[model samples]
Target: MPTSDVVVVMVPFVAQGHLNQLLHLSRLISTYNIPIHFISTTTHCRQARDRLHGWHAHDNFIKFHPLHDPDFTSPNPEPNTTTQFPTHLQPSFNSSLHLRHPVADIIRSLAKTSRRVVVVHDSIMSYVVQDVKFIQNAETYIFRALSVFYILCFNLIRLGKELPFTLEMKLRLPDATATVSQEFTEFLKLQYSHQTFHVGNIYDSSRVIEGKFLEYVEKDEIMGKRHWAVGPFNPVEISPDVSSSAQQDRHACLKWLDKQPEKSVIYVSFGTTTTFLECQIRELALGLEKSEQRFLWVLRDADKGDVFKKDTVRRLELPEGFECRIEGRGLVVREWAPQPEILGHFSVGGFMSHCGWNSCMEAMTGGVAIIAWPGHSDQPHNACLLVDVLGVGLLMREWACRDELVTSVMVETMVRKLMGAGEGVEIRKRATELGGELRRSLGEGGGGRKELDSLISYITR
Candidate 1:
């Protein structure tokens, strides 16, 4: 007997989005009856386990292994000192730099006991693709975890000449041609001529397998054909609880929304991690008030951290029933909301968002236009895609403000545009078309679905 069988190992970077992708992938892998060992820092591993609480038998086949800090074990690094766990240990920590060594070591150990071990990884940890011996599985599949459109944008930049400024500078510039290399300008030319946008190419295999948006555009060959993009996957079913937190919030919003007329509410949420200064929060509240539009706001208690204690969820000082003032008009509140279900709600007309990819996807898929309020990281890039490339969203100014945040005027303008009040109808039409295309990508026999099935076959075989 070979005494070796396939073991799938995943070490997702510690972040909500990254973890969500890995967990979704893990669920897909589990359906194949393959053994899986998902490795993570002690805290993260605990959290992942908690998400699936009571759902599975705690066993070897589907195991959650915690990597604890060596210092915390027994012999302290020194009598009074302790070794620091790698920064990747917590979801709130920056994970890019610290995960490589620990992950390489874990995969190496797994290889010793399994004859056919495979490493499934996220794009954020793309460095693993270069370490062959560390992951000596019969197969190693690099899971690309970005949308094909985003990947295309990245690849086009890579394929062309270096631009004078950074990619960010180029995207942020109001005029597209001002900051980029001429070669890129020409490439984008060919792209738009063909009804495509030249999204540069930097891919994650996990994304192609997990990204639910690849089925929209026509697929073409690029990078001379890489082993990547076997995915851009979409599982036919998402467990009701898979996104329960977001859903729970969504239900609450619906209660307020049910009282309003169709397409009357503008939804605002900055996502789980992003926080704004008190000044900015107040501006948003006032902006909602000024817009005179009915709204459902999900405000986090920690928006005023340091000023408030951790247990102080109740001391949320608002603009004095600004809730009462906006009464019958707007609802200002806190707690997690079911974002996707809310975006898809009939009452939601526009979204004031932080432009996270998942949020962008859900909003667009639901035919809701966005007021892009990008905070950091890939959000700015995604905002560019939404505003410049897709034309379905409006861009909020970069500066933070409470009075000026989403001022009543801006809110009303966005509402008119998003709700198709006048010339805005065109934007709505474009958004609706994109939603249809996004749906087609996930529909039965669609590219995303087919790709997902192909990924499952690859993992099981």
Candidate 2:
């Protein structure tokens, strides 16, 4: 059990990837008998609960605080737009600033009852908790939802240090500046400036795969801050029985995987924020059909500018007769699919991903190789880590040429190469080996476990 005088509050960015990371961390922290308050918009708070996996025994230790954003409006996406990034989410990001006052009020109220209120907030959400420094009984820490490799590279670039690898300077940097609207850019600026005060840093990363990068982040004079890499934050175990019936229903793909051969299926998902053009979607569908490989694809609409409103008219339609032709060879899940469960299954051999840090961590934990097709932001950097640094995946497309449409032929070729016998065999072996190391790191007395313990102790003290 932890000290009664201490309580921890979590503030995560509203995106699915960001929200999920902090929620997982909250669950881990709750295991130490520490109470956690997870705060976010009402929609996101509901998302966190609905998507939560594994055991529910620790639910009492964690609480959800949902704040309403009245000015927010979900805008319909322009499916024909040339931009590759999820620019449609700008409204949602801008509206999050409205939460500052309410979030601060909640923190102030909590501080009155607790001797120490430790605020762990997303790096992009620092502005929401800007008032923490003035609260006599409270302190704040920054939680980086990205991988250590990407974080190290970003800091190096910010400090004007030469990059470790040869790549376009623009591709390595955070692409939000180039892709987002001016209003969103200003919002980012506010967040950057407000992060001036924080007690320490926390990362959703681990020493096993990113040891050198983690060291660089900790040693660099300008970037160095007391930090912990207690990650692969998602549960490492595969516990099907722990899921509720509704969750089980959502994960019907697992039943299909059970019937497939060992390491024979590839799981494909671009995450919640990636928007695809109809033509591109068609090409991808045709490509999967041509690859002739067993696959499980999660086909969901991109997030709207205002997430609360549904854009029923502008749906992403698959190529006509595509599903019919690939009937037994593929499974298309139109709703939310249990990602961790799918990745951990025995039949899942690889993942075709956007290389978002959360997806990267889950893939690593599952020991699955990647077929990297990064869109924007830190995704390209993450793809580089998986393909070049880790040697456990293959890059299907580079970010420099992301503007061009990837044809059905190219997708087919790359998919076949990753699922077939030569280079794919080597990558899969390395992925499996690395996955073992990552899982072990979360075990008793391991590096991740120790770092988490140290973090818990620091907060309580």
Candidate 3:
């Protein structure tokens, strides 16, 4: 059979996290030899181009097209590259606001020669609602990069008086324990019954849940049959050189971690896009300091200059000498770090995270527990899944003051509890078991592998 001529256009907002997901999907599509067109702002395209400079050697199988979106440019002077991206700008969202025009143009261009055009798009750009009819003769499929569970929640919110009158709309309600309304929950069940495909979590299938949650998901056709979960799809190699200049000093964080005892180091990162007000950053620093445990932190543009001028920004402040006191005991990365490899490292015992899906999945694969501080959006939801449902993480409430930052005393206490203190050993054991299952699911003929095959078949045929 002739190869299906399809144009898979990914109009990703610029942030590294969004790019990672878009690129992973692109790579999978490319492997099937489907024509893929990836869209980004000029700045983002340049970033991707720089990373690919040495990697692909001019391979044209995947093409990058930059849209002329003004939002792509950062107005502030570039802050010195640091541990995480400055919060002032989120490039990943640049194209989303004005996505329809360019996307429709691309589809129209492709229609001149291609028989069918299937556009797999990120859910955030659901604004495609307006342009969906404009893209001539193309079948559009929405791609939700989040776990199936989260997608189900989103769909529930989108529902109208559907049956079982979901838990969100129910008369009788569960206590403070259940965040989602019973009416909404029932609506989700009804949606599942109606045969809509919800993505199944590949990592969860291999994990060992505390109260047979895995068994429940396995038997429920709504979750088991429809949704596809392929996660932590970081395209960067596990080991990228730590230095840009040959002579610049490179921190030997992994080497130091090698000497530490197993499960001793806590990895702390707020992801590439979250920017805390200066006070919060300082409190976090002080909390880590008080914790006294060996730690690895990524501190990007901490002074808040990345978001706006420090003087102009009212809430910004980093604790004085916070790094000096914790210097040797911690390895602080200023820019980007190879996260997946670091998470998989033996020295990483636990994670202090912002609860992003990619980080959550990586932690799950590493079998490391988490101390979650959800900054925004779906992070809070992800945190709930980790702490309440999975039993693999501790929920850290939002703290504005130093006293509440889970000081060294609290850190030590929590670590002790998670390590084997209060039913800690069992949680650790379950996490390890889940990690093993995730590895297998990504391996030959595993659930993840099979799902990718099915997704490809759906798109290609």
Error of 3 at 422 (Å): 5.1
Which of the two, 1 or 3, has more lDDT? 3
- Candidate 2's TM-score reads 0.93
lDDT score at residue 20, model 3, on the 0-100 scale = 60
Q: Per-model C-alpha lDDT, please?
A: 0.55, 0.83, 0.57
User: Could you tell me how far off, in angstroms, the CA of residue 385 lies in candidate 3 after the best superposition?
Assistant: 0.9
Number of the top-ranking candidate, with lDDT as the measure: 2
Pairs of residues at least 3 apart in sequence or in different chains that clash in candidate 2: 73-306, 74-306, 75-306
Which candidate should be chosen as best, given TM-score against the real structure? 2
Residue 416's lDDT in candidate 1: 52
In candidate 3, how many Å is residue 334 off? 2.4
RMSD to native for every prediction?
Answer: 9.9, 2.7, 7.7
Please give, for residues 80-191, the per-residue lDDT of candidate 2 as tens digits: 6666566777778877888889999999999888899999999989988999999999999999988887777766655667665557544544543454456566777788
TM-scores for every predicted model? 0.68, 0.93, 0.72
- Candidate 1 vs candidate 3: the TM-score winner is 3
